[model samples]
Target: MPPGITTFAADAPTLSAANTGFMLICSALVMVMTPALAFFYGGMVRVKSTLNMLMMSFISLGIVTILWVLYGFSLAFGTDIGSFIGWSSDFAGLSGIGVTQLWDGYTIPVYVFAVFQLMFAVLTPALISGALADRVKFTSWALFITLWVTVVYFPVAHWVWGAGGWLYELGVIDFAGGTAVHINAGAAALGVILVIGKRVGFKKDPMRPHSLPLVMLGAGLLWFGWFGFNAGSWLGNDDGVGAVMFVNTQVATAAAMLAWLGYEKLRHGSFTTLGAASGAVAGLVAITPSGGAVSPLGAIAVGAIAGVLCAMAVGLKYRFGYDDSLDVVGVHLVGGVAGSLLVGLFATGGVQSDAKGLFYGGGLEQLGKQAVGVFAVLAYSLVVSAVLALILDKTIGMRVEEDDEVSGIDQVEHAETAYDFSGAGGGLSTRSTPPGPGTSPAPTNKKVDA
Candidate 1:
C-alpha cells in the first residue's frame, strides 16, 4: 500500500490473482499485434520491399519497450500535470515499487498495467510504418519512432486515459484506444508521409501485395488477439463490462468484414482476400474505442459503416496522389474517426458508464465530447509528427536515394532479400542484379493479389 494511492482503507484493494493473470495474457496478446501487423503489412508490399515492411513494425517492439520501462509509462499513467502530461516519482524507471503493489486502485499489480499499456505504445508507432514502407531509411525511421513516441504518443496517451487527464476528467469515453492508438497513428502516418513525399514511381509502377495468404494469416491473428485487447481494457471481468466489450468486439468486426466485402464486390466487381483482411481490421479499429460502451447491435452498425467508409477511403490515396504504400490512413484513420464519433450515437448509458448515446436518447452532448477528443488527438499527432518528420528529413534524410528504392529497399538498406533465388535460376525476376531507377520491369504474370 503506497501512501498516495488513497484507496479507502477498510475496503482496500487486494491483488486479484484472476485479473493479474488475465491482464498478463492480454498484454501478451496486444504485444503479438506488432508482429501481426508486420505480417499484415509485409504481405501487402511488393516482394522486393517485404522485409523492410516487416522490420518497420518489428523494430517498434524493441524501441518502445526500453523507453516505456524508463519513463514512457510514467508520462502516460502517472499523476496528471496541468491536464496535459503526467509524472510520478516511483513510475520513473519503474523504480521504488513493491512487487505486490496494485496499480492505483486496481486489483492488478502496477507492473501488470504498465506492461499492458507498454504493448499499446509499441504497436502504435509500428502502425505508421506501413505508410512509409519501402522508401524510408531504417535508421531514420527508428530514430523517428524514438522521438515520435516521446513527443507525440506519450502525451496523447496521458490526455486520453491517464487519471485526471483532461479527456478522462471531461468524460470523452474512449474505452480502449479509438482516438489514442488508431487515430493517433493514422494522423501521424499522414504527417510523416507528407514530409517524406510519395514513393518513387508511385502510380506508374503496378505495386501489389506479395502474398495475400500471409495478409490473411496476420489479420486472423490480429482478430484473435483483439478480443484480449478490447475486453482486457476493463482490467477485470468481474463486473461484466469487459464481457460486453468482448461481445461487441466480435459483432462489430464480423459486420465490418461483411460490409467491406460487399462494397468491394459492388464497386470493384469481385470480393478479395485483401478486402476481407482490410475490412476485418476496419471493424477492429472502429470498435476499439467504443466496444465497452455500445450494444452488440450498435456494434454491428458501427462496423458496417466503418467498413464501407474505409473501403472507399483507400481509393482516396490514389485520387489525392499520396503514396500510402499500405492503406494505414484509410483503415486506421477513417475507421478510428468513425468509431470514436459513433460512440456518441451508440453508447448505452447502462453499459460502461451512465452516459447514453444519441440513438439511446442521450442527445448531442456526448457527441460533442467525443468530437473534442477526436480532433484534439488528430490535430496534435498530425502537426507534431509532421514537424518531427520534417526535422529528421532535413537533418539525417528520411528516405533512401531514389535509385535504392527502385532497386529494392531490402537489398539496399538491409543487405537481404525476402527470398533467396540464387539456386533457383533467379526465380521470378530476370536480371541477377536488381533493376535500377527507370529500368524496365521484368516479365511476369500479373498476379495482383490485393
Candidate 2:
C-alpha cells in the first residue's frame, strides 16, 4: 500500500466513510486473487498432481493470515527501526490499536489498512509455489514458505513500503508491489528451485498444462481482482490518481495480451490460449508498480515490451535447464523488473508525484534508484530463500520419495485425486458411439500424463 505518499499521525486526515468503504471492498477483491492463483497454477500441472499444485497456493491463505495477525504486520509497517525494519508494541498481536484509529494520514481506519496489506502479504509467498510444483512434499513446502516469508518477504516489504525504509526514503516508486511481491516471490522461487534441483524429468517430458480452460478461468479472475491490487494502492479515491491507475491497468493488460498473442503466433505459428492467459498476467505484474505514475499509453508501451520480453524469457529454462514448471521466473521476475525500470522512462510529473520520467525530462537518476530497489530485493530474497530451502532439505527432508513423486503427489500425499469418475457413468466407456449413417465411429482422445 505504498502510494508514494508517507504521512504521520499528527498530519492525519479525519476518517472518511467513502475511503474506508472503498478500501474494505478492495481488500476482499485482493483476497480472491489467492484462490484464483491456486486455480491458475493447479491447471498448469499434469492431472496426477493437480490437487498438489492447487494446495501449494491454498496453504498460503492459512499460513500467512495467521502470521500477519501475530507479528507480521508489526515487522512490516510499525515504527521504523534504523531504516532496516519496523517495530511497535501497539501493532504486535494487533493489540492496543483502536478500531477507529486512522492509519498514517489516510482517511481509513488502521484495521482497514492492516487487512488490505495482509492480502498482499498472503499473495507474495503464494507466487513462489508455481516454481516448486510436483516433486516437493506438501509439509515441506508449507514449512518452506513459513520460513521464506519471515526471512525474505517481511524485510523486503519494509524496505520497499514501510515508512523511513531505505527504498521508500530513496524515492524508488513502487505504487503497488513489483519489487516486494513479484520480484521477491520470483527470486525466492529461483533460489528454492536451485537447491531442490529439477523435477524428475525436466527436459525429457512435455509437461504441458492439463486444463487450458481452468487456466483461462483463473487468469480472468486475476485480471478482475488486479484492479483492486493496483488502483487500491492509492488507499483512497480523493483524487484522479486512482482513476488514471484504473485506466492504465486496463489498457496495459489488453496491450500485453495482444502483444503476447502476436509474438506467439509468429514464433510458434499458433496463438495458444495459454499464451493469452500468461500474457495477461505479465501485463498485470508489469503494471502493478508503475501504473499510478504512467499514462494509459505509457502503460501500453510497458506492457507490450514486457509481453515480448517474458515470452522470450520462458525459453531460458530450456537453455540453462531449470525446472520452473509454471514459468514463474520468466513471467513474474522479468515482468516485475521490466515494469519497475519502465517507470523511470514513462512517469509523468503530474500523477502520484512531481517526478518526471526520462522521456519527460527526468534524468537517469530515478532509473538508478529503481535498479537499487530491484537489485536489493532480488539479491536478499534469492540468497536467504536458498539458505532456508537447503536447511529444510537437510533436516526433515524437502522432497517426496522418488516413487511417490514419479507416481502422483495427489494420491500419495493427499490421499485424494482431482476427479472421481465412479459416479460419471463409471469413468469413460470403451464402447464406441453409434455411427451416423455410413460414417466411422469417432475416436475418444485419451489424455496422457508427462
Candidate 3:
C-alpha cells in the first residue's frame, strides 16, 4: 500500500469502454506530438541541420518506447521505494500483470494508462533537443537522452505522480506536467548547453529558421495534439474535469498567442509569425498544470502572462550568453514556472482539486508548495543533467567536429539531406546556354522557356 493512496473502492477491476476508447485515442494523439515536435524543431534550425533536428525528436519515440515497456514504467509507477523513487524491477518487462486488469481507481486498463504515460516520457527528453540543436553528435544525443531519462525523468515522474511521492503527498497540484515535463526539460536544456558550450556562430551569425512555413505546420500539429496531452492526463473521459481542461487548454493557448504577438510588436517594432508560434507553445506549457484548476478567465490570465514573459525570456540567452538555440529555457521553463506558480494565486476549489489559491482566499500556503515543487525539480534536473552532460562530454565526446558543424550535421551524421536542390540545378539559375562553338548544347528533350 503506497502511503498517500487510500483503498476507498473495492478491487472489482471493472473497466469502462468509453474511458478506454478515449484514452486510446488520446494516447495516439500524444504519440503524434513527438513527430510534431520533430517538425517544430526541424523547421527552426538552419537548412543544413534540419534532418538532424528532426531525428533528435524522432529517435525518442523509439528509445523511450523500448525503455518504458521494459522497466521505465515500473520504475516510475511501481510500488514505492521511499518517496524519491519507485521499485525498479517490480514490474520489469510488465511481468505478472494480467490482461483485463484495471488501474486501481481508474476504469481504464492498466496497459492503457501505461501507454498513455509512455507518450509523455517520449516527448519530455525530445523537448530538450531544440536547445542543443546543430552542435551535438547523433550518437551522443541518443546516449544522452537514454541516460537522462533513466536518471532524471523517471525519478521525477515518481515524485510528482507516484502515490507515495513527496510532492503528491504534500498536496502540490500539477494537473498534468508543467513541473515534470516543461520545467524539467527546460532546466535540463540549460544545463546541457552550459556543459556542451555554444554553436560556432553563437552570437555573430544570423541563425534564422530556414522554413517558417514548416515551423507553422509543426506548431499547428503540436496544437492539435496538445488537446490530448492536457485533457488525457485526467485518465478518464467520463468526468467533467476533462471537459474543463479541454476548454481551458484552448482558451489559454489562444490568449497566449495574442499576448505574445502584442509583446513582439512592442519590443521588435513588428509582429512576426515565429512569435505567434512560440507564444502558442508558451501558453500550452503554462496551462498544462493549471488548466484543470482555473476558470476560462483564469486560463486567459495564465496564457497572457506566459506569452509576454516567455517572449521576454527568450532574449535572456543573448543577454546571459548561453545560446539556447530554440529558446527552450525561455518558453518552456519560464512558461512552466509562471503556470505552476500562478496556480497558487488563481486556483479555485470548484475545479478538479479542492485547493484554492491566494486570490481565492487560500492564502500563500499553496503558492509556497508550488514554488517548492518548481525549484526542487529545477535544481535536481539542472544538477543531474549538468553532471551527466559533463561525464558524457569527458568520456565519449558529446559534440560534433568543427568541420562537421560548419558543413552540416545532416550530411556528416545521417548521410542524408532534408532537401535536395540537386534536381533543380543545385538551386541556381534554371536557364540553359544556347549552342556555342566547342560547347555541347542543353538536352533538346528539355524545353527552355524564355
Candidate 4:
C-alpha cells in the first residue's frame, strides 16, 4: 500500500457498514446524474439533435467505466509519483488489493472508494458535451473524452485529491471538485468550442429549447443526485460534516434558483423555467466545493452571487462569438470559480476542516490559494482540449457535414430521432424516414397533422 494507508488486522472490524452503504448509495446517485445531464442538455437543443445530446452523456458511462477499471483508477488514485500524477500501474486492473483492505483514511472498502471516484471521472468530461451540441460526431466526441480524461482529468484529480498533490499540499480548499471537475470541464468546453467553431447559424438562427419540461425534470434529478455528490465526499456518515454540507447544499440551491428568477425578471422581463433550472444547476455547481466549509448563510451568499453572475455570463458567448450551445461555460465555469473563490471569503473552519476564510479573520491567504488552483486547472484544460479538438478536426473530423448538420445530427449520425409524429393516430411514433435527396426535411416545430 502507499504511505499513510493502514491495513487493518484480520480480526479488526475494518469496514463501517453505514459508511460503506452510504457511499455505495452515493455512487449510484452520482451515476444517475450523467443520464440526467443527457435529459438536461437534450431538452435544450433543437428537436433534431436531442438523442445525440443524450447519447453524448450516456456514452461516457460505458467508456469511462471500462477505462477506470483498466487504468484510469490507478492513474488517478494510485501511489503518488510527483504530486502531479499517480503511478499509472500501481493499481492497474485493481491488482494486489484484497476485499478486506480499506482505502487510505476511509473505513469503506477500497473498491467502494474507487467506484465513487469513478462516478466523478465519468461525469466531468460528459459535462463538456453540452457546449458542443448538434455539431460534433459521436465517434469523435467519444475519442475526445477518452483522451481528455486520460490526459487532463486523471492528473488534475491527482493534483486536487491524491496524496501529496501540490494543490492539496498548498491547502487549496476543494472539498469536492470545484477545480478538478467543473472548472476543468467548463474550460475544456470553451476550448473545444473555439476549435470546432460555431454551429451553422449560431447567432442568426433561433435555437430555443424544445422541451422545458424535460429540462425541469433533468434539473430535478440533478438536484436530487447532488446531495450524494457533495455530502458523500466526506466518506463517512458518522461525521457531522456531511449533515452540514447537505443543509448548505439545499439552501444554496434554493437561494440560487430564486436569485436567478429575480435576475431574469429584471433583465429579460420574464420568469422562465429554463432560468430556474439553470439557476439551480449554477447553485449546485457553486456549492459543490464550498458546502463543507461555509455556513447556510454563506451558502446563500455564494448561491446568489453565482446565480446573478452566471445569468449574465451566459450572454457573454453572444458578445464573444463562441457557441456554447447549452451555456456550460457560463454556468459551470463561472459557478465553479465563484464557489471555489468564495470559500476563501466565507469559510468558517468549523464544519469540516480547520481552514478559515477571509471574513472569518483568515485574511487573503485562502483566496490566493483558490485563485491558483482555478487558474492552473483552467489554463491546463483549455490548452489540452484545444489541441485534442484541433487534432480531431484535422484527422477524422470533429463536426458533421453542412447537409447533415442542417438535416439533423440524430438522423445522420445515429439513424434515429428523439420524437416522431408520423403515426396514424395522434400519438407518439418511433419511425423516422430520412429525407431523400433534393427533399426538404419536416419542420422541427410541427406536431403530427391529426
What tens-digit string does per-residue lDDT give for candidate 1 at 1-450? 011245788878889999999999999999889899999999999988999999999999999999998999989888889999999889999996789988866789999888889999999999999999889999999999999999999998988888878887788988889999999999999999888999877988788898999999999999988987899998876889999999999999999999999999999999999999999999999999989888899999999999999999999998998888899999999999999999999999988888889998999999999999999999999999999999999999999999888888999888988976545566464566778999887676554322
* Candidate 3 deviant stretches above 4 angstroms: 1-13, 88-90, 424-450
Off by over 4 Å in 4: 1-13, 88-90, 427-450
TM value for model 3: 0.94
Per-residue lDDT for 209-252 in model 3, tens only?
99999898899999999999999999886659999999999999
User: lDDT, candidate 2, residue 89?
Assistant: 86
C-alpha local distance difference test of each model: 0.90, 0.90, 0.90, 0.90
Stretches > 4 Å off in candidate 1:
1-6, 424-450
Residue 94 shift from truth in candidate 4, angstroms: 1.5
After superposition of all CA atoms, the RMSD between model 1 and the true structure is: 5.5
Candidate 4, 1-450: lDDT as tens digits: 112244456644458988899999999999999999999999999899999999999999999999988989988888888888887464788876788678876688888888999999999999999999989999999999899999999999988888877888788888778999999999999999999999998898899999999999999999999999998988878868888989999999999999999999999899999999999999999999999899999999999999999999999999999999999999999999999999999999898878899999999999999999999999999999999999999999999999899889999999998875565665433437877789766556544311
